[model samples]
Target chain A: MFGEFNLIDKYFSARQAQRKDVHLTLGDDCAIVKAPDNVRIAISTDTLVAGTHFLPEANPAWVAHKALASNLSDLAAMGATPAWVSMALTLPHIDEAWLEPFCHAFFELANYYNIQLIGGDTTKGPLSITLTVQGFVPQDKVLLRNQAKVGDWVYVTGELGDSKAGLDVILAPEKRQEPFAAELEQRHYLSTPRILAGQALLNLASAAIDISDGLISDLGHILHQSQVGVSLDVNCLPMSKELRQFAPSIQVAQQYALTSGEEYELCFTVPAQNKGTLDSALAHCGTKVTCIGQIRPQGVFELLNNGQKLDWALSGYDHFKEVK
Target chain B: MFGEFNLIDKYFSARQAQRKDVHLTLGDDCAIVKAPDNVRIAISTDTLVAGTHFLPEANPAWVAHKALASNLSDLAAMGATPAWVSMALTLPHIDEAWLEPFCHAFFELANYYNIQLIGGDTTKGPLSITLTVQGFVPQDKVLLRNQAKVGDWVYVTGELGDSKAGLDVILAPEKRQEPFAAELEQRHYLSTPRILAGQALLNLASAAIDISDGLISDLGHILHQSQVGVSLDVNCLPMSKELRQFAPSIQVAQQYALTSGEEYELCFTVPAQNKGTLDSALAHCGTKVTCIGQIRPQGVFELLNNGQKLDWALSGYDHFKEVK
Candidate 1:
């Protein structure tokens, strides 16, 4: 029970009281939030490593962009409008030239979203950034993980596995070809957090989550939390042209799509009756949503292509579990 | 302009719209907070490096205790009653034996304060802990650094230099004396945040800050923020019997008292009118209050003994500036 994931549950979750104020706390993207004036707030914390999450010698702009974007993605999953942020930056040393572009990119996204950098700590240490973001949602409209129904339709915004391909391009640009590499790396470094889409789905989607981890692992969370299963058609897997071109075959591209992490896309569930209105609701969000699968009453997450079952052991990016 | 400290001031703090909701946002012990129901909340972030903040071989219990206690001290400075916490833990690996005591010590203090561990992220990295603590302070009652006035009486709770003496013992236990070592080490390892005293001083004190980076540096914050200076009585430093016994001389003990960090004791300023009520107000907090000095109208921080001025180039711990 004291495994990497369950350590938090055993130690922290087991002892807490049933706080009435907390709408949804641990085991989700964001933390407990109970605000007032009919606008309850939500909060989430994420930490990014310089050498691990981004390139060691990365564009400080991308470092700043991804650090804040990933955290905002958590808020987007919760159907909250971001309002304030507290950033704790640990730096090996202060590099002024590197910081200018980094700060420019961080505040660019922050200002566009009207989020204020309320307070933070600048300490000398390893190169890492930890951001805690707070956002506002209506009192009764928060999208939660446990609300998915068995008959709900599974939907994901934008293409999945593109960022993973982006990672491949970033790791070895010399091995990667020209045009595809640029797009793949762009998606990898600059995946937009679906904040508007989250708010749009607040009234329609029964449950929601962001795809930071690969599809299988991230979707498995919904299955476990909602106590429902899902069945997806492998043929419907949305692989990008860049990813498909980069892969050896369609099967490999599908594998990457299913198991690649850091996509920053929204995977959510809409009830059968609400499915018709889902597309129209998110039309203004500037992101496309595709019907990927349907929730089932029983059985584990399954994949089928042309009526043939396909099995694979797939997981998202886990820091503790070494992946090679 | 963009030095180590100013990097935050120039970049993060420079471009922010002052929302009316945030009473005190940047440049403080805690983040900006505005809550409803007559109880505003305070948030503060702190990151402790494994080798930097504590001994690498420090007991797991002490690691957890100091990590949480230090964050709580920030809320104490803001006169906030702690309510919730979000902890992001970076560890090289999971050691169950190490975690048992760590979680035990963490939850023990959390339960005592009635604070809930709402959410957290556990990741694999070098050992470090980043904790963001949220606490409720009454509207219009939060203490700030800029509230100090000319001629205000300055005071600190409990002894100042005991913790630093304890750190010395921790670094070189073989060279330290017996009975004195345990007491000093205990003070160093476990510092009680003066929460009750902070709340008690809300109506009595003009300004307050937790002595984290030594009295000289921390009090300097109050002086710079309030635009006032102070002359402190050298002989009046509240040094413990253990510190005096362990120190080479009374002067070295005073040196430690003036510039030692991580004390967790509060250095606060009370207006001249509230002087008489200060002792009675904080009497029930169980920490003895010591009047070290009085605020001056001008000039930098000064130390005085009887009638003569004692000068020493002293500063609290700085992560950027190396300390011998």
Candidate 2:
């Protein structure tokens, strides 16, 4: 008859922190959190499933990291500072070995971001994780996709397509059996560093979105929401040297960079006046911020190669599409 | 191919009232919610599985209602006003018939509480639902179980054991099939009303918690967190007449009232001076508030019958326990 009390005390009770904003935490019906006076809260949610989102044998630590990081990236896109989170975990059974590393990784990231695990629910089912995160931004400071005005310069943080290259190595390990492929495999397993740069660009950027569904597809979200279009130079798409070397061809590499997902980088639009400020911020943060394209009044997305228009073959990874 | 945009627009988007606190809602990477100065946010999450929490054939509307209502009850217990919610839904397949009713019931309750569904994630899997609800309360006004003190009077809203009685009717439909047994069965499918009564009691009450894992078990949480003890009157335990009529004996009815989970009523403690104010608030709310026990100096919880202590069972529903 081990009831909710014993289960909570045994597994989750002591792991919480004592904070001024946390009036109540684990062992109660719900947890309470205090918000700062001048900050608005940003929230996002994501769910990951075994077999669908990750391999069954993937490290539980990585699984925990990726799940929380993915949701946090959404907050970053909105130029919000990480604050708190709640997790709902469903598992086939409780395995102590798996729970230890999973909790360690989860708490490590949470502590790094100063985010508290305020509340959660646990149940028995196939392995799945759902995370909802709360973040804070000054009033009216949130970056929104609909705010991208025509002539705003589009920029992306960090190199793209590395995750896609990593995925290729994982899906076809035998095809890339060369010794140098291990680095590619690591990229797929560990996601990109979160774009904390959005915090600095909050006042400067007109619109922003996280790169989770490839450059072309996620950029489409900003375009559709802002009721505008874009014309990107294909050569301008940033890629890691490691990604270029592992890719099958230059065209294939370009296509993967345009359509790969899980990069966790920020794609934002800044006014021309703020270009120097953005460059200075990026240099101070030691992260690359590339100006890839600009917003246009037209309603169509276009790609140009060597100053000539090229027909794009793929849009991005669509969830309902037949897997390639 | 279905991507994130159409998935959200077609299935998740809805017209919600423009909340003064919400700067932005769905269709963005994250939702922007304003938190006023001097207000603390309370957050909680819960997940429901098809076969474990409800029958597979359960009404979709009730399933959706119970899922969100149960989480909202946690907010009510903390005396927090509902503000935002996000859902994670996994389904074997999409059925329009099921989705329409489910969404209707879900949105109906959300509207009633003025809580908006700001964001969510949907995927294919076994039928499961995870909901995270956000609530706001004035700074220093949030109720917590740890604030209860010795000499405080313990109280509860609404009767207990009706849900368990309803479950009995559902589990054994053929035993002495009474007229309106179908109505009794409906109770199992329906959710308990949240006791918004806590909002009025926040100033008067010393501490509070929602009774989801029965009165005795849930009170233990408050006791443990507050470092206090309780002496409950077994004769004062409230139960519906229908529950007593259906139970095998008075002791069984008492046990059910003390140990059944899913009541969703609030259990709270208040200073002796505020008893009159408590009566007025409950009266104005049109709900019954009963004083069944009192807080005591640190010790084990006890049950008294006619001024004499009685040995009682301490057990309730544990989600991870194996069914007999």
Candidate 3:
């Protein structure tokens, strides 16, 4: 019997009341947030749709986590500290049962980052979630894709391919019986956004991007912006034990590592002189940083396996072609 | 042949290249925005779903306008000057015919507001559009709903009931032949967000909220936030000549004025002393302002018809109830 306004008042407004930076809350036409001095606001948005982004029957809590985490990962890639977020949630129906855990997981991540849920819309429609996250970084300190210099070392945080393999486990129920299936599924469903690691890399990284698209496609962005090519060492691509065990062969595991999307891992470049400092700073954040490649002057992206060039079987998601 | 990335690069990225505040471009994991010094970044988000927010076959250009305009209205309500926006567009298919006009209308509004589309996700799904808008307001000067004073005069900008009548004309296509139907439909399709008027009221008004919901429903927010009641004069409610001709009776027109939503006009509160100054400022903006009520200390809301209390048949949109 509760209306949309009543539901929001009960679940969301109460949670939104605790933030100091929020000048106005949910009752108004818009909420006001105070941006801090000396920091430029970093903003990013993502939409997760049923069937396209996740299975319709997927757990709502995991959906909530993935949606928020993906956006947070973007701010992390920008080396901006997480601050505020707005969610426009379109639901086919207001199922309180589903909403309880979804809000729980959403607030859990929001609390972890100390991010405020400023304002957004909730309407009846096809089930989809669009979240926009904002962060702050000193004006001169924002990490950008165009700043990667030739000769800079390329580094990525944490192991790759787990989420991709985890997705496979999700799609094939029989794979659930395999060893490490639950862990892989967890990786696929509730990937951690590297906020602390990104924060740690604020000064050490020259340019950064989150590996949501495949490594090649995402790195292509840096190359196109910085106007420099990269020689990526395929052998150096990090893979978890779960990914190795789940894949049929080493090549499959390597392919997954290279082409997986939604890994939410940071791929960044640092000058050779900052290697020691970057390693030491990232070490305290408890995330594994692997040096995967080096930036080159020529604008050609190549993958090298044991010093031999290789071709990819697939090159990440393309919405148009995928639909066809 | 054009994929999501190709479409973005060809159309979106090209247009986005012109913004100076954009620290990073569309290809990055997240775009970076620089909010100016001494200004707090005001952010708001809204989602428009086909079949719910608008007709399924509505013009894509107007859909684009409504989606962005509604969000901009929120910033206007907050007395904020818009700067950047991010869009997460969900499409069932990439119909170039639809996308061309949609982008045209969307970018046109962005240019008018001097806003930049920083970054967002685009994917194939049920057709929907969600936009997050960011604006700058001086740190000390934000207008808020909670600041309405007990003795403040309640005012609203422009005619209200036209949009509701416009919507009626739309749903009942036969009504389009009625007098002033085109104007009513125009109001319904492209409700102006009073950005200039709101900016003018920044220092003069005590509190403000944009009327997206009916006057009563939205005003309830200010009452709740400010802990003050209001006695709204039904006679003072603004209704266009088109609305009067469209309605069957005067009472119906009055009801529409009270409960019609999506007017995108500013409903504000000002002290009696600032009336002259407020009038002068609003005159410069060329927006109609009508004083309709007075804020009171007693916690009660009642509609007055020529100084006599009257019951309202409708209370505006209740999303849950409407769906059921």
Candidate 4:
């Protein structure tokens, strides 16, 4: 008996909390928001399809979390403070049981980030979720991939490869009995966006990006944009105790840290002069930072094991390319 | 030859024209946009799915146009000027031939509206497009649905039933031999958002909404929000000559105008005193304005022909209810 409009009104609209900057909120054709003059709004969008982004039978709470988390991760990578988000959700059918947890987790995360749910669409289709997040960054403090200096030290926050390992366990459940299966499963379902760390690095880090596409392929984007190269130390790549224990072998651990993705960690570059301030700035932010590489003048990205270059065959996630 | 990233880089990214207010454009995690001090940003989002929102074999150009047009219409309804848009497009396969025209028409419309393509995601899934549009409206000029007062005159701009009539032709192609079949088909595929007229009415109209879900249903929104009611005159309902000529019967034409949706026309209310000003404001906007009814204190909406009530069975488009 609950229809589309009624479902949205009863569930989604009630969760749209009031914010001071919103001139017009939900129930209107569009939401009107007041933007501060000195800051520019950073905008990003992402779409999650049922089988592609997550397992069809995945927990609805995790699906909602991941949908919003990916977009917020983009804002964090851009050194922006999230302000508002709009979600277009298409579902195959209406199920109150499924939506109860989905909206609960989504609104919980939105409140945690201090971002308002402004406006969006709901339709019936093959299950998919598209989210657009907007945030504000003060002028001259916005981070860009092309700003990495040649002498900058490359750094990453938190452990990498955990999410990828978690995904592996899910993909092949027979492997779930591994050493760190529980930790990997948790990592896959719950990856936090480094919003505070990104903001703290705004005036300190030269360039930054979120590791959705893995470290090697993502750093390649910086190299392409800045016309610079990087020498990443394979030994220095940070891996959680769980990742190290769960990975089949040392080489597999390294590959997961370098190529397996959806970790939502910050990979950033700090100029040599700012090195002294980097550790102190992020110390109290609950996230740890590690220096793992250095920017180089050459236009190539290389992973070094000790002093020798390592030949890696695996690449990061590419939708169509992986299929072929 | 083209994967997700390559296709986006080769076609979509190149067409992102530079704007003075854009701090960061494509090739980054997010796009940074500047919003002027005295203006509030208007945000809206919409999703269009092939075989649902459009024909599976519909022209890609028209598909892209309708996707953007629908979101832009939301902004227009709020009396905001469009500034930026982000699209999340999911395609089952990579077809460069279809995309060539898709990008061409999409950018053509973006440039025409002075909006920039900031950032979005391209994924592999069932064919669907979700677009989020952002615009700016001066602090004092924002239009709202709840501002209409009892005794205000209700008005509608442009023809109301054309788009739905056009859809009728498309749905039943055997009727394509009807007198206005070509015009109806064109209207269905190419409905224009009333951006200019919305802006023109910003100061003169008391309450406004774009007609997406037919006049009766959409006006019900205004009535519900404003705590008022309406008495719509069937004789005053605007219909194109082509719609009248092509309709199988007069009742069918009236039904199409009343309940057939997706017209994208502006329906608004003006206080008695501002009637002269309203006429003068919209005089040169290239779209006709018609006085259709009057707002009433009672909280009910009714349609009448020659002052007699008519019982109609059709309701507006509700995704779940309609499907059921």
Candidate 5:
């Protein structure tokens, strides 16, 4: 036990500098965090099981980064500034080599966002990680999915489908690697940029959600919550060149673009009147914001290809569905 | 997925009314909570895996209560007020019967403490629960385990060793039902009352920790952190009459008393000068505060028996150690 503690102290403890808001940190049974006045705290939690979320032999650094980034994306979706996070990590054994890179990458992302590692539990079990992240939002300014209204234009940040293309390469390394396979793999490992674009869109977007379960499925959440529907332009779906190159067919590329999971970009709705301002904010943030659809009064989702409606075989990734 | 969502709405949603500090409750990616002025939030998290933490056949309600209570005890140790908690539950299947009672007991405790269920993630996996709890403490009055000084009186709330005694009954139901095993079995199901008494002692106690990994091991943490030692009166170790009757011998009961885990009582250090005030506060809270021994400058943990120090065979429960 002391060996484990010392290992954690030697490698992970000082990797990230303590933020001013953290009154007390890791060495205690719990941690103390101070929240400034007039700031609402947004909190979200996510758990990743080894076999379910990532390959057992996947790079530990990327695993750590992706796990933490997934939860941070939730904070970003809420238009909140990342503040602190508590990680509950359970592992079958402690590998110093794995711990070193994992902790380094974990803290690198944490420090980049100025988020403090407040508290958590480390125990022995199947490799699993549960992270509860806290973020701060100015009073009356937090974003939600239920706020979308009719005539609001739907927009997304960054390209989608690239992550899924990357994951394909990761899960099946034996397959012949395409010219863009390496690039796709890199996207799979690194998470989408979040805090900056989210902060810039906070005042402009009416409703927003991070695209985790692909664009279509995740967008369905916003539509359901807001009691609205959407008419999406299939041709407007964002796709990286790497995804297009690796996709077996145009249909497959479109399917992956619409339904691939682990893409942490934000899909949001904004009134037509605020489009100019939204565009300006995106430009200032230096992030791509593509208008792909519009919320409608009728509660039905439709996809238009060129001038005719088309049916896509797959809607989005569902945990219960058979994996492709 | 919708079924699980409905179950959550039915069972967990209404309980939000019990918490006054919650600005926004469930149904969002994250929950928002407000901290009172002059109070710093104390946070802790714990993950309990099925088979590791409890028997697979254990009642769901008890499992839920124990999971939340264990984390809540961390707040109690710091003399903080329980404010909110988020629970992540992963299970192989969704059984309505299991969820109903589990949520019932969970909210019962949450409502009693006014700790709201803010936000969490639910997914399909091995039966496991991760609970992150938040508590509030006056900025200057948070109790820590590194403040104990030489000569401070060592005190503990409630009786110890019952949970371990209860485990004995769980391991052998037939023996558990024999003669005096009924009460021990009952103790296994219901947990120790959290020490609300600690709130008043926050300013009086030098250092504190919750007794989870038995008295000997858990108190050692305080001693190690504070750079002090302790002399415990073995004869003064508290055990329920039921535990004594069920044990094979007094020595066995003593061993269990010193080494059992899951006793969620606060173990604290207070200056001898503050003994009277501490006694009064415990009495007012209707909880027992037993002065078991005193803190020493530096030495090995000593067990005083018949006015002479005696060697004890078993140390406290070490998670990494093989079970006897």
Candidate 6:
């Protein structure tokens, strides 16, 4: 806290939003905000720790973007329109080089979503950032994981697994020379949170979740919550061209798609009746959509490729029990 | 995240408030809450790192209480009625022995305040707790530091410095033999958030702040924000009998009171005409109120003891420049 205000004024407070709803912003003990009437606010908190969520030596801008994007993704998964965020940032020490672009990328994303930076608590500690985001969701239109019924078609917005492939290059520099390395890295660092797709899925999709912990694992959340199972086809899983070219094989690229722990895509399930409307609803979002599976009756999860049963399997990097 | 849901269901979801405003609580991608019509929300975030904010060896219950109490203090400073909280808890590893008491104490205080635990994101990392709290306040009744004007009388609710003396016993066990040692530690570990006092002062106080970084340091915030200054008498500052008996001298006891970083007392400014109403407003809170300072003309801060204009100062543990 020794130069806390100066640091915030120099970097953070410099990025003010034209958000008129915020009555009090930074520099005060607390911030005051007004919520629009007739809407419920969806809220989520995410913490990214040095060496746990990202490498301490990683680019500050990427760290800031990833931290904010993940939280935005959480709100998106809940079909909420992003609005305001409060950050609790702990730093080992102040560094101008680090703070400049960190604030820049963070505000850049905030401005895109029209979200206001309402409150900030910066303290001295090992590097970590915890962000709490609140967004407005129409009172009657909330997407939840427990609503998918049997026979619902599982869908995902945008390609998956490219970021995992992208992360490999950052983790092992030799992968930098791999085919389409830059695009893969872009997938990892600038992963897009599917806010538009999530908002669009609110009425059409029965259940939704962000596929950060891999699709199968995250889709399992839907299965568990809804008390149903799914018959998923690996061939139907979406993949980026770069991920396919950079990965050793189509199978390996699909493997990456199945288990990469940082895709911000929305994995949702829609009934057959809404399938036609779903495509039209998402057409303007400019993000691809693919049907990956069908919800099955209770206790029946099957993996298929090209309508043929396969012994293929992929588990999360951790939490193997969740994979099944 | 292996057992994240189970942990939350066992500890957090068990402590739900009967608050009907909450649409959803823990156990989802995001929690949802609705704001009552015509009220703006007050928001704040506080991050407490082990060894930085609390000793790593401190009891889990104390850590939990201190962390939550400190955040409640921030919201109270803004004159907001506590409502909902979201926590991002990063633990080095999960231990039932540690988590049980930590969750118990956290919920005990939260339930006492009738705040809902809306959103939680638990992760694996070094121990740190970041809490974001939101409360409702009438739109026009916000008490901001910048609103204090010249001639306002400065008042603080309850005693200070005893917590600092209490911390001394915890830091060095030999001090445990000191008179009123148990009460001192209780002051440090179980400090109360002055919610009722803040709610009562909404219309009566010109400006306000929660005193955690000592009186002079926090009061300087008012001076800086209001563009005015104050003449405060240290001898008039309130002190507990326990702190007075424990300190080697009256001066030492006053020093402890002036610099303790853990007191949750509400330090506020009231216009001269509102003084009588202030006492009546805070009467039911069961806390002491003392007038120790008078606001001065712009940029003229003076510290006094008795009738003597003696130059005496105490800096924050860090941030020397913040102390006048």
Best by lDDT: 6
Runs in model 2 with CA error above 4 Å? A1-20, A173-176, A317-324, B1-4, B173-177, B307-309, B314-324
Better of 3 and 6 by lDDT: 6
Candidate 6 lDDT over residue span B1-324, tens digit each: 547878888888877776999988886789999999899999999989997888898889999999999999998898899999999999988888999999999989999999888987898888999999999999788889998888899999889898888878888888788778888888887889999888988989999999888887788788888888788788997999998888889888878777887798989999999997887888898878999989997756666778677555576523323333
* Model 5 lDDT per residue over B184-249, tens place: 766666775464776888868999888777787778778878888788887888788888887889
Candidate 1 local Cα displacement, residue A109, angstroms = 1.4
- Pairs with backbone N, CA or C atoms under 3 Å apart (clashes), candidate 2: none
State the lDDT of candidate 5 residue by residue for A1-324, as single tens digits: 224456557766777677888888877767998899888899998888777778778789999999899999999888899999998887778877888888989998898888888878777667778999999998878788898998999999889898888988887877436688788887886876477888877889999889877888788778777878888887898888888889988778888878888899999999988998887777776778899989886456677888688775675524212211
C-alpha RMSD of candidate 6:
2.1
What is each candidate's fraction of native interface contacts (fnat)? 0.17, 0.84, 0.85, 0.90, 0.60, 0.83
Q: How close to the true structure is residue A186 of candidate 1, measured as C-alpha lDDT?
A: 81
Leading candidate by TM-score:
6
Task: Please give the C-alpha DockQ score of model 6.
Answer: 0.84
How big an interface RMSD has model 6? 0.8
Please give the TM-score that candidate 5 achieves against the real structure: 0.94
Q: Across residues A165-260, which tens digit of lDDT does each residue of candidate 2 receive?
A: 877777785847765477766666566445468788887899999988788778777777778877777788888878788777888888888888
In angstroms, give how far residue A204 of model 1 lies from its true place: 0.5
For all candidates in order, the CA lDDT equals: 0.75, 0.78, 0.83, 0.84, 0.81, 0.86
Clashing pairs in 6: B161-B257
Q: Score the docking of each candidate (DockQ).
A: 0.15, 0.73, 0.72, 0.84, 0.67, 0.84
CAPRI level of candidate 1: incorrect
Write the residue-wise lDDT of candidate 4 on A146-205 in tens digits: 889888999998988999899988998898887788889878868898999999999899
Q: Flag regions of model 1 displaced more than 4 Å.
A: A1-36, A316-324, B1-36, B316-324
Q: How does each model score on TM-score?
A: 0.86, 0.92, 0.93, 0.95, 0.94, 0.96
| Candidate 3 lDDT tens digits, A1-324 | 126678887778776536777776566666777777667778888899998989988999999999999899998888888888999999998898889889988998899888889887898898999998889888888778888888999999999988888888899999899988999998987878898888888889888889887676677677767878788888899998888888889889988988888899999999999997887788778899999999887545667889998766567423212211
Displacement of residue B138 (Cα, Å) in model 1 is 1.4
